[model samples]
Target: MKVVAADSSSAILNEKFDPLTIVATAAVLVDSPYREARGSLPEPIYADANKGYEVIVHEAELCLNLLEKTKADVVHLDISLGAISLEELSPIQFTNMKISTLGKQHLLKILPRIRKIAGEITRKYGIEVLAIGKESIPVRIAELTSGANAILYACEKTLKENQPVLLGLPSKCQPRISDESAYLYSLMAAEHDVRGFAADQSGVLEKVHISEVLNPIARGFRALRIEPKT
Candidate 1:
């Protein structure tokens, strides 16, 4: 008994390898990378200055979604909820509220299916569908999401700047992580409690305000934000 106890003690003292931490690898599908580019690097939809892969989705192009080329834990839709003006946009100055209204309605009709596809994809791949867009897109997504945070993304700058004048949205961000990956993962986690995003590289991110993203959209766009259901 004494000899065995001594041997056990020596083994414990001679342990070499360090402890291992639990790690999770996640993949996200982004349809469009055109909207938010900061310098040469594509600014992730959500990322933390202090950590890794909070949100990393490649540009999820809508044209290829039908082909099943991408699978994501969470998808950042590329479809803009606002409309493209047929009323001679070149002549119309300032914001086109009327045209935007038409766009939102179209977005509304399209989203239920988007929700369905999001749900279907999440079920098939065991992931979550995140309904994100400039300003109004999230609102429409939230309407379908039923008091869920499924509707979230960086807001447009005009709304952020004119928040006091024209606060179009009803609810706040609902205490969700604003970082793109965190936002994406949270929605995914809401569905299946997944673990991580794929952007694990060092120095893969930069910082900017959410309001900054919204600014360009309000100015004008031929932009689109897709719903999985659509």
Candidate 2:
């Protein structure tokens, strides 16, 4: 008897949106404090983490619930390890985890298992489910910087699958500098996608960098159109 309230601020409520617009949610282990209910919201919300691998199944179900409620075109999730530890660590420890290759690899290993949940949900709902690690870009720490590249990769993968899933990205990409923590890549990858540069090799539509694909600025692009490639 869990009830998830719809917040008006949710992007899914937008009347006009990009065809690739996706809903994003985070998947964490059960008993995670980061799952705290917002604004006295009801208990048993999907944000509540489930322990162990059960989290994958639980989050997949939650995604479906969200889809049913919002009729969202796509749903994507940010999967993470150390669900409990993520919130318990000190700032330095938390900061270190963002750049730790071993930490990311450990989390990446869990994605395949979770992708199975996406497959299951796809069959049942006829919708696409996309997943990416929170620290999807291994080379950069997203703590105070941007993760445009990782977002682009996930978006490309989602388009290839013809599934709707949230494309996780930093609101803004920061400039690269001498600070060791800064992301080395430029923000063009994300900006390019927003500008509507896309590619279709056979039939699947993939987002292309501004430089990678011809700019669609002439006619303008708003949504992705699925059509057969001739």
Which lDDT tens digits does candidate 2 get at residues 1-230? 12121110001111233222222222211111212121111112222212223334445555555545443333334444333321122333435555466545444555555556556656665655544334332111221111222233333455566554332223333322221121223233433212111122222222322111111432321222122223
- Model 1 residue runs over 4 Å out of place are 1-71, 79-103, 134-230
Clashes of each: 29, 5
- Model 1, span 1-230: residue lDDT tens: 00000000000000121111101111222223211111111221222222221111222222124215433334434333233321212222324444365555544444445545555555555544433333322222222221111122222322333321111111222222233432221222232321112221321112322221122323321111212221
**lDDT of model number 1:** 0.25
Give the top-scoring candidate (lDDT).
2
Q: Which candidate is the best by TM-score?
A: 2
RMSD of each: 22.9, 18.3
**TM-score of every model?**
0.24, 0.26
Q: Following a full C-alpha superposition, what root-mean-square deviation does model 2 have from the true structure? A: 18.3
* TM-score, cand. 1 vs. native: 0.24
Model 2: pairs clashing at backbone N, Cα or C within 3 Å? 30-49, 30-50, 74-164, 75-165, 76-166
